[model samples]
Target: MSKSDNLNLPIYDNRGKPLELAYHVTYTLRLKNGYILALKPGEHIVRMPNLLATDVKRRA
Candidate 1:
């Protein structure tokens, strides 16, 4: 995916306030089945997916 398609999701604190200097930039790819795959560059790749999944479940 192109850089323009990346999502810059803000990092929030426990109080639900967005952190001023923290942000997560995800490279997104849209699948044929309409699922979006977001990839964040770095070692957090292993842990971030589960966090994202839980967040999606809550939102859904």
Candidate 2:
């Protein structure tokens, strides 16, 4: 996607890998129950030291 495109949508990496709009840069993901996630534009990756949010990602 272009830099002007909406950031809420899913995107692909340089490797053509599909990535959900991550708190940080796009990467592989493994989901768990009770974990929530959202992709917002930011320089920092949102880390949930505790899974308080419904969105979360683990290693794939």
Candidate 3:
């Protein structure tokens, strides 16, 4: 299966509410355009909306 089709991760919102909970693989890489590319990892947690908690994880 393609990468996009194989994405299975848990995506939660600011309220810790599950948005898309599943399993997938993620990777972070620096692009030449000065942009960050994040590839969701398998069984990862991807939160949305208020990304306060998500930003905290990135700092660590």
Candidate 4:
């Protein structure tokens, strides 16, 4: 595993909606420029479209 690995962390959207992080998000990353290399399969991978929320303490 690399330093970028988050160990399948939970991800949510800005609207407080739970998102199913999966391998389908690979297309968003540029494979040629090397901005991203590969994505972890069968794990909850957070994409840029979502936010990595540690907790909901800020919720009203």
Candidate 5:
């Protein structure tokens, strides 16, 4: 996928509200699955393949 394709993913706020624009994107990381993770002032947004699935496992 291209950079422009990555930008097509929908962004959401911390409260789960869809956002039209994401300003001051402090950091961006590309996930192994080709999704982009974007972080702003108050929250981090990522486009996952399964929104309802819990992908992260905590290590103790």
Candidate 6:
């Protein structure tokens, strides 16, 4: 996976990998107990941190 903001996102597994649209990343994951387990470098489906949200653009 290329190094980018997507690297920070979490995923469900580290096998097939998944993708995050906003962050433009990919990762593999497995859902467990309403939580995601396992992770891959390119994945970015996980919720971002509050601190990271600082960059989010506000709606008009």
Q: Which candidate should be chosen as best, given TM-score against the real structure?
A: 5
lDDT of 6 by residue, 12-56 (tens): 343323334335544455564333455557644455333223323
The model with the greater TM-score, 2 or 4, is 4
Residue 37 of model 5: what lDDT? 42
Q: What range of 10 consecutive residues in model 6 has the weakest lDDT sum?
A: 51-60
- lDDT for each residue of candidate 1 in 1-60, tens digit (9 for 90 to 100): 646866555443223322343256544332211233343344122222333344644467
User: For candidate 3, what's the RMSD?
Assistant: 12.5
* Candidate 5 structure lDDT: 0.42
Q: Which ranges in model 4 have alpha carbons more than 4 Å from their true place?
A: 1-6, 21-60
Alpha carbon lDDT of each predicted model: 0.37, 0.37, 0.39, 0.37, 0.42, 0.42
lDDT of residue 53 for candidate 6: 30
Please list the residue runs of candidate 5 whose C-alpha ends up more than 4 Å from where it truly belongs after superposition: 1-7, 22-60
Model 5: how far residue 23 lies from native, Å: 5.7
* lDDT string, candidate 2, 1-60, tens digits: 647854333343323334456454544433423332433334233443434232234332
Report the C-alpha displacement of residue 43, candidate 6, in angstroms.
10
Cα lDDT tens digits, model 4, 1-60, are: 647755443434323344455654642222321123233344333444323233345333
Q: In model 2, state the lDDT of residue 56.
A: 39
lDDT of 2: 0.37
Model 2 residue runs over 4 Å out of place are 1-10, 24-60
Q: What is the lDDT of residue 29 in candidate 6?
A: 54
Clashes of each: 0, 5, 14, 0, 0, 11
